[model samples]
Target chain A: MDEIIRINHITKEFRVPDRHEGLRGSIRDLFSRSYHTVHAVDDISISIAQGEIVGYLGPNGAGKSTTIKMMAGVLEPTSGEILVNGCVPYKNRTRNAQNIGVVFGQRSQLWWALPLVESFRLLKDIYQITDAQYDEMLALYRSLVDIEPLLHKPVRQMSLGQRTLSDILAAFLHDPKIVFLDEPTIGLDVSMKAKIRTLIHELNRRKNTTVILTTHDMGDVDALCRRIVIIDKGKMLYDNDIEHLKKFFGAYRTLKLRVKGDLSEQAKRIAAELPECSVSANENWISVLVNEDKQKVISVLSQLQKSYDIRDMQLEEISSEDVIKRIYEGGVV
Target chain B: MKRKGFRFYLRIYFKILAQDLKSKMSYRADFIISTVGMIFTNIAGFVSFWIMFRNFPSISGYSYHEMLFLYGFSLLSVTPTQCMLDNNWNLRQQVYSGDFIKYCFRPINLFFYYESEIFDAKGLGQLAFGIGTLVYAWAKLGLAVTPLAVLKLLVFLAGASFVMAALQTAAAASCFWIENSFYVLDLAFRFRDYAKYPITIFSPVFRFIFTYIIPIAFIAYYPGMMVLRPSEVSLLSWLSPLIGAVFFYLAYRFWMYGASKFNSTGS
Candidate 1:
């Protein structure tokens, strides 16, 4: 649980020229230049520990990529400090890069025209990996990600899923202590997504590699991360364990009731009698939001059954997507 | 580490260069056509000068062969810098596409990333043409072939390449602020135009500026003067290359500063 990364009050701003539309405005812009500052990453701080897979969740343009770039030393913070493995990422980039790996899902770090193995070899030279160590890591990556068919194929010819898998493998081949994966499984099929998730989990468990992942896929969060940090509008809204997030903001659970003899009125009365529930009727099924604890699920179902002949019933727990939607809509936690 | 260890990096660098060459060779016909086209384009400039010299016989106090020496050496000094550092010419695209990120994470000096991609097939063609022109000028001018003159010429050529590479790198590094300043590269080559002739034809102050401020004269004129053993070629001729070396160092420092700015701006 030792801290591997410490980001303290990091902020980034960009000065963008103000340009107007049309020919006249373009001419004026050329002569009299003006600019406005964009606050891409606001003052924010978060620390991640060793072997922890934390979900950095945010919508597009919410500064997720900016933060990852800063952490990876691809960009410097406008203000404040970032320390990875006890070194400033920007000032000591080469030293910091030696122990860290990064992958941007939108871009391939692998050489586009070369075979995947060739790109890996180039990386080995760039990172100065020993021959034995390179072979060992290549073997491990091949076993974990099914990269055998991919090693010989040119990167330009590989499918998106194949390329993504290769990219993930390349990022970890150097045995970096900490890896930043930005949308690692983006644009992948269901099976590919599952395979990547398993590979990530295996890497973390086997190597104790700290991972910081920024993804729009909620399934990625549910499947891999035990902790989550959500940011929006360049501000951190929540940072805690997944269970706490579900408990704090996961307010409503759905109950689906199917009753006999069109007993719609009786179901409504039953729902009304239970003040904690909100009722909605559709066809022969009545749906209710049970606001009480899940312990009350049985009681609520029994009450509905006693009043009306129950044909079938179903219950669903609140999902992470629902929790995120509520948070985005400014729901109280 | 020992000085020999630096050679290891250079060896690896050439491997990468070989890989790039292989990739470029994939387009075989285009490569051949471009190589031929480059020779024709360079010859066109010399052809214009030959026609001018044929009519007038001399420009100011210099003859045709003497001017060819200046032209040939200037082009020769520039080819090594331009061809080896071709990546600098595309710095605008690198900045716009964020490919600079690749260099930021590497354990090597970022300057090498900008320097290594400079050599390509077109540059090799230019180098061939420059050398051919130099040999032609040497034979026609009846230039003195003393061992000392040859030694000084080699030293001057090396210093000239260093200075030219540094200037090109500085021009490329300016893209960090201006973003898409490929025009700066164009401006640099325009100044190279000044090196195609002897600086002795200009006023003293103009000569000093080209030699000291821009150091274009170091790349061609001073070296040409040293080889020709002109009376004006004093001890100052030997020291002029130091100007090129110092400018190279300053340009390198500026490139690092610009890289730092890129890291902060992230544009």
Candidate 2:
């Protein structure tokens, strides 16, 4: 794939005033000055290719937003370089902005009291879209996002989901080559989230728009992105295919078994025999942790059946949350 | 594309301004009351001057009507920049809220974006009243309608607006380091209050300061002085607007420097 964004050893640091907490401390803080330097985005390097939907995964204060801000031309890196579409974003903001679209989920860019249509008209003027192009793009967005019902509604009157959808549409109205979405489905309901995800997939497939999405939801990653980049403490910890991420960190599955009678002795024996598995028994239910290579759950059940009647058996795939927790706790990847 | 640039920015500006007005109009009573209140406040300011002038025959060799011409012109000249560009006045909030991020990615100039957000109907109303007051003062004073005087006034007004706008922009840009710019803006306002009256009333040192350093005299006193007393139209009078323009350019440079600092600091 052709490279669409090339971020080379980008670093961003901030100097925040060091202030004491109390009233007395505050008065002293006015006269006595101190500052603490925070490295919001360290010397990090990553590149995204054309038609790529990269999932940028991180917890809060993990520099995901800062990185995005730099790429979006909202922030300048303290040192190092970032070139989006062969243009340094902060240095050539107008040209960079023409080729890029950015959406911040927490803020609505639409005019608050104006109808969605009016905002679109203003955007067309701001972006200098031709009349025909504006019409075609608006029609396309209306159909894709089903924004017909929302066209006449004032932005402040629209629901969060509606507003978010409109914001996404507004971002794409310029037909930008790259779109940066920060928490695009942050506060949406399950159905709205699915709709947004589907819309994003469709947009990518049809337009081949390069997308960089920063989201907290793992489902957003699983459903949309084939690649994932994870960062923590202003450093990139993982940057590769999603499957590789899962393979490296997303190991271990759970086996939950329900038996008919009290089988504490049998459970203990099984726990002792299967040293690789973690066995937990509560009341009539027993849960066993199994490695990825061990899939003969039937054999374990058969052995358990010799001592106690098996009432119900179920197997569950290890969730991504558990994988992340294990990664954090074990420092595995 | 070059020809279209100004029209493009102006179109977007008016569209945004219209939206702001509509939003304000949603509170119909508040809009009306505020507009009326602004007119009353301006009238009160002029009334206080009238009362003061009644006791004193003249101030610094200028009569009441002549001073009103200066005051009215200064108020009118700065109104558009103040009312339209006042959004830049909230640089403190913009910094704290990280709202400047929005401007960085826009395909327009940051100055235009900063000015557009605060375009309110109340401001438009004030601007209209200011212009009206200027015309009334001109007619009452029987100021000359010579082409040269009109040309000078227009240049002076444009230059004054640019300087005022740039100063506010510089103050707002201070948010990069200070995080709160309102105090700086407040101080700038106090400094600007000296321009409300004639610079002739001040000492030679102060006159020099207003003319060369802060340069508020270019907005009203200098141009008005040149027009009302054509005998004083030296080369300096014609060059005063250039000083304002230079100050405006410097202020713009200061704003760009602050923005770079902000970008480096990140959100």
Candidate 3:
């Protein structure tokens, strides 16, 4: 595989006006205006190979979008360098744009009121794609998905899922070297999510197109990405394959319990008692990441049973979501 | 390997324009209402002119037909911008919402891409109304439609259209710097009203401002003067097309500067 993207210690800083609270403060602010810098992406370097589906994961406001924007040539990094397919993206944006496609999840790139195919045709002309290439892509789309039904449907009338699907297809139509999908599976149902994931995976396999996807859904990461990069607070936290990430929280099994008392209090108690395991509460379910090397699950359960009433419990392996949560919570990275 | 030059862009432009028209035509009622509404608005404006002319033979040195010619030229000049540059009006909203990234993602020029986003059909109504007024006024003034006159008119119209689009683009490009650029663009829109009247009626300072500062004079007033009173028109009137071309180039440069300063809204 070829290294198509090379990011070297890139940092993007935004200077926002320091707004005042009230009338007097605002008046004073106008007299002496102030600005503070926000480091959206700080000293992050990543080298991505061609034909790789890399899940770029982060919590909300976690610099994932800033990184993606830099890659897509939408924003220039305040410091350092970023090269995509041997071109500095922001400097040679038009040239970089020739080799990349971007889909910002919150907005549709499609013509809002036009039929879906019209947008595709417009893209065809913009990309200057040959007729044969356009028809072949259309045939590929039709074969992979039941796209014929939605081809003539106006984009505004289509459901969110349908619109997202169409948008993904549009991004790939030009056969760009890379595609940046920001939250591609956001606000989607399970079935729709599955379909999109499958479509992305199939496209990657068929075309060997590099995919950089920013998503919150761990399910999407599990289904599509072979490797994942996690960032938090403008800093890189983790970057490795899924299995390695899971193994980072070695021999950990999730001990889920439906307790009688307040979930938070119970969680705290369990945390105090176990000492080695990480415990978190959500509604009535209290989940504990119990390390088998440190303590046996049976013993931990028996100890919990002695103090509190455990109505129901289940033992399972640590999931990717838990690993992400642990990293997000600044627990075991 | 990349297609370059005017022909490629022209082909793509027509395709985008077709898509825009197709999308707009879907709402048949809205299309009819807006187009008809525009024509009616122009008619009401014409009625106001008729009332003014009926009360007095001439407001300044110009006759009723000359006033109509000035008004007609203003309308013709503005029609191109109204038709093609409607997307610039919403650029602030698009930028704030981060939807403007769509322009950055395309391989084409950003300004060209923005222009291709939509085609305003309501502008056709204005175009029709403008042509009708100019023809009526021209016949009343007894101005013969010679090839030389038509060629000169074509140049003036093109020049005026470029100026109109340039001003709009320059105003809209401020969205990249400020949060809301509507006020700035509104000022530009208000200045268009000044072009419909004779600048000679106003004070020298204002005349200079309209001519040099904002260049609203070239949009219609100067061109109108060039056509109606070629002997009395100044040398500046002959340079309307040059001024327009230069102004448009400056506006385009400003747009590029603003875009470079663009730190897109956080996603």
Better of 1 and 2 by TM-score: 2
Please identify which of the two predictions, 2 or 3, would achieve the higher DockQ against the true structure.
Answer: 3
The CA root-mean-square deviation of candidate 2, after full C-alpha superposition on the true structure, stands at 4.9
> DockQ score for model 3, please?
0.64
lDDT (0 to 1) per candidate: 0.80, 0.79, 0.87
Off by over 4 Å in 2: A15-37, A248-325, A328-333, B1-4, B22-27, B203-213, B233-236
Instruction: Judge the docking of candidate 2 as incorrect, acceptable, medium or high.
Output: acceptable
Every prediction's TM-score for the first chain?
0.80, 0.83, 0.90
Please report the TM-score between candidate 1 and the true structure.
Answer: 0.83
Cα error of candidate 3 at position B256, Å: 2.9
Q: Deviation in angstroms for A163 in model 1?
A: 2.6
TM-score of chain B of each: 0.91, 0.90, 0.96
- DockQ (C-alpha based) per candidate is 0.29, 0.45, 0.64
Q: Candidate 1: lDDT over CA atoms?
A: 0.80
lDDT by residue (B1-267, candidate 3, tens digit) is 475689988988898888778777878999999988998898898898899789999977888899899899999999999998898888899778766767778887888887788889899999999999899999999997899898889998899888998888899998888876899999999999888999887899999898888888888988777788888988888888988998999998998778756655455
Model 3 bad stretches (over 4 Å): A253-258, A262-268, A280-285, A296-299, A311-325, A328-333, B264-267
TM-score, A chain, model 3: 0.90
TM-score of 3: 0.94
